[model samples]
Target: MRMLRTTLDHVRLRDKMLLLYFLCVFIPVVLTNLIFYHVTSQNVKEQRMQDISRALEQIKIEFYREFEDAMEISSILYIDHQLNELLELAYPHPADYIAAYDSYLRHMLNNTYSPVYHSVGGITIYTDNPTLLNSGGINLIDERVKSLPWYSKIPPGRQSKPIFVRTGDGTGEQQHPFSLIRRMNYFYSQNGHEKILKIELRMSSIREIFHNLNLQGSLFLLNERGEIEYTTDPKVDTNAKAVAYNELQLPKDTIEFKTNYVLMNSLNGWSIVAAMPEDEVLYEMQTSRNFVLLLTCANMLLPTLIIIWITRSLNVRIHRILKHMKKVKNQRFELIPGTVSRDEIGQLTGEFNRMTLKIKRLINDVYVADIQRKNVEIQRRHAQLNALHSQINPHFLFNALETIRMRSLMKREDETAHIIHNMARIFRNSLVWNKDRVTLREELELISCFLEIQQYRFGERIGHEVQAQPEDLDYLLPKMVVLTLVENASIHGIEPLKHGGRIEIHFELRAGRLILTVRDNGVGMSVKQVQRLYNYMQRQEEMGERIGLQNVIYRLKLYYGSRFELNIRSALGEGTEIRIMIPADRE
Candidate 1:
């Protein structure tokens, strides 16, 4: 039973635990969501419906205000005495009546509509004989007007009864192509007889009014027959009052939408109705809803995430502490950042810091002891190297001197004496083996001895030249550097050639660099051997021991680092050229 429970616990760890933790936090949130759906949505819906009703009332008020202004302007043609006489003259003598007509027009447009109504296309005063008066005139009578549904509704004579007509202006605004018209009885005295004149009104001037209303949801202007006389939209099924209001027997007199909108037509003659969308009505509420959602989601999710993160962070820190303790058991002194506070984590890190410090002190003592031992070993090895070198140098010098003495005793003395003197000089330089550095002049003298010995062995078969600037001789250089190079050329390079070869050593200073080159006309190395020499130079830097070429490379790097370069160019039959560059030394 215990094992089964432990296995189950293990299976429930990690992501499973994290998911369960999130679910535990989610339960209350789900319940709250349910409560919100029950309580708040009802209140929100009611609020939206009430707001939509108020918006519809406001729209009705706006339209009524527009209708009132249009009536007042149309009433002017009936009441204003001078304007009527001007319109009569402007009709027949349209060209000659400019000043009178202009004054009439300026007055006609000014009082026609409210400032909010910019849709006044033009105001027309039509007389009993179809005489039309218009400002900014384009004839409203077009072929399409004869075919309009409202055009045939006009009575035979311009009667006193109120009549409405929709006549197109011939321009291609399909929905707004038609203008609203009203006919009224005009009464005046002419030649002392009672003259009954007919007056006509075209409310194309209201087009600008429709342009401003927001028309997205539902906008309709109804006639008394429940027919849509003029609407912002054409497809509103003007005669079907059922579609606009969802009721059969629509009101010729009332304003209502979905039992919410309640603005009735205040004027029985002509009225315009607009139904503002529910979304547009309560646009401000939508922003409040979004803000609530964001604020609620953040308030809920933040704490849950922080709690889960804290637990996971604690687990990570514990794992680091365990790993550090394991490393300590194995006796490693390493720096690990401690938990840097007085909290539980901080206390654990403090203990770890003490352990690491103690381990470091113990390691330091052991390291110092080991260093002393290494220094002693290095001193012993250096002593052995010095003793071996001392024996080797004298042995070589004694043999070379004895060979020169024998040669002198046998026959030649001049060149052999010179060779012996060079040998003595080489011996004198080698005695300063305690010093790691020597002058280039000393190394060149050593090279002279080495070459003299080689020349003696090879005779005229080997030939060489040395060209050096005088300033280059006193430069500090590694001891025996020139001797090793000359020995390498003579032993490995020249001696291998059948007829022997010429070697040249030249030194120059160019462009902040000291350049020394050695060229040989002997049998040269293959590409593979050249690569191996390059590898030998590299290995000495990685490992501090040098067998041959590595020693020269080490000495150059020890002094110059990146400021030195050794480049070798060689081909099988064409021989070899080695160029060494060192940065010009100031001190």
Candidate 2:
């Protein structure tokens, strides 16, 4: 220890200060900032990837949803005994068949299902029964019809299941239509008559679905053999023959996302693939890098200047003291003479020590406290800025929808205009989260708009009823709390049902608390699923698919703290009920 001390003492003060600055200030600051920058960049990249992945999943869902209409129509037609009997009758005369066709087939073709499933372009029945008329959506399976590419491709057997196929007009002049095809062999009484059902899907409608999604990438639907059946990439001519997936060139630096079809048996081996550019995914990292660089410069500059000034002052003062000590060593008593500044170095003597202590106290009381206060204020301002930035996208969306609604109104499409207006209201209320609490009336308005939009999509498939007392309408609750629950009910509960279902919302004020209940008579959850959902709601972590439920739970906790209760009860095939009880707030 003594040897080390002697070596350190022999070192010049400036050299020691330089070493201290390199070790304590420069190295630590640079390393910490570098680490901070790296971690921040990684986090931003990961978050963006997650968001893109979720968007890809949503796109896949939407693609399936568009085709779901065609699938449903095919399924309905496949098992329609009336249609089977109509197609099976061996009418002796063409007039007799025409009468029968006009009575049933014409009505079925023109009125029954077309209005319900707008995604269906046309439905045609092909039969080899020579007695039937060849017109009015019923084509005789003659040489031309039999020689069609899609017809020959159907596997020969008793196997009867709907399959999705892209068919053209035989000539290469027009675009191919995506269709669902199924053989009508379900009835056992068929006397060797070949029956085929084809439901042509609206290509424009499918394209619109792809266009409406706010995903940053090219989307492709690949069949089992890796052939691109449908694509949003404008470079490829969709009107041409099916392109091999590998032949399509993507961006050099791209991230690919893929999701396979599981629910639709007809689309068993089909997959949705998305090619997103790396730059698009990590676009925000450039801003983050610039901010980090600026912060690092500020962090380094302030500490460097402070350290240089402090070290210089210490070196000069200590050098003078050392010179006086050396003079005293030559047999002369000498007192060091200088006006000492109020610092740690000044604490070496009696009066100087008292002044130094006073200065230290003043710094702790004023300067340090002021710095902490400013830091808090800066943090508060940053939060406010972030909130404002978050609102920008929603406001922009709302304005765009308003413009679309006005255009629709000008075109005299009242129904479309009304739906767009409801959609706009939903986007505004749900996304622009400017407040923590909203009156029950305002929340109900948002829910009403949301339900209206859903009704437009589902038509008569979705039913809703709201029961609330007039007095309860004025009660306050967390914004979107009820709407989130209603959405969950609509999507998870009602959406999966074949015939669809009803959603009921009830609001009651009892004692000093408010009770809000959202129930759906759709497909429900099992006991274990309910337990898992409860556990998920109780968790303080982010969830991917159940984010809506988590958001509602989080907001309730934020607004009411521990003074809120949420209860979920469900049974498979019976539907679900979510009830919430919170202290009534009038302010």
The ten-residue window of minimal lDDT in model 1 covers 191-200
**Per-residue lDDT of model 1, residues 1-587, tens digit only:** 99977866777245655666667666666566556654565577667666655555565566555545445545555566675454443245545455664666565545544354444344544333223434443133445644656556665564543333444433454333333345433645342211122122224544444545443445565655455555565545543323433333433443334221233322464444555555665455566566556756866787778767977767677677778888878876565674376779768878887879987888877998999999998786567456544544564666667677677757867777776767667776676677866666766767767778778879888998998778877666556655666667777778887785788888677897777787888788899988987876565334233435555665566556677888989888778888888866533
lDDT values of the candidates?
Answer: 0.59, 0.80
What lDDT is obtained when candidate 2 is compared to the true structure? 0.80
RMSD for each model, in Å, please? Answer: 16.9, 50.5
Clashing pairs in 2: none
Colliding residue pairs in candidate 1: 119-208
* Index of the highest-TM-score prediction: 2
**Candidate 1 RMSD to the correct structure:** 16.9
- Badly placed stretches (over 4 Å) of model 1 are 1-271, 275-282, 286-290, 293-344, 387-392, 395-413, 448-477, 495-500, 506-517, 526-572, 577-587
The per-residue C-alpha lDDT of model 1 at residue 455 equals 85
In candidate 1, position 408 carries an lDDT of 78
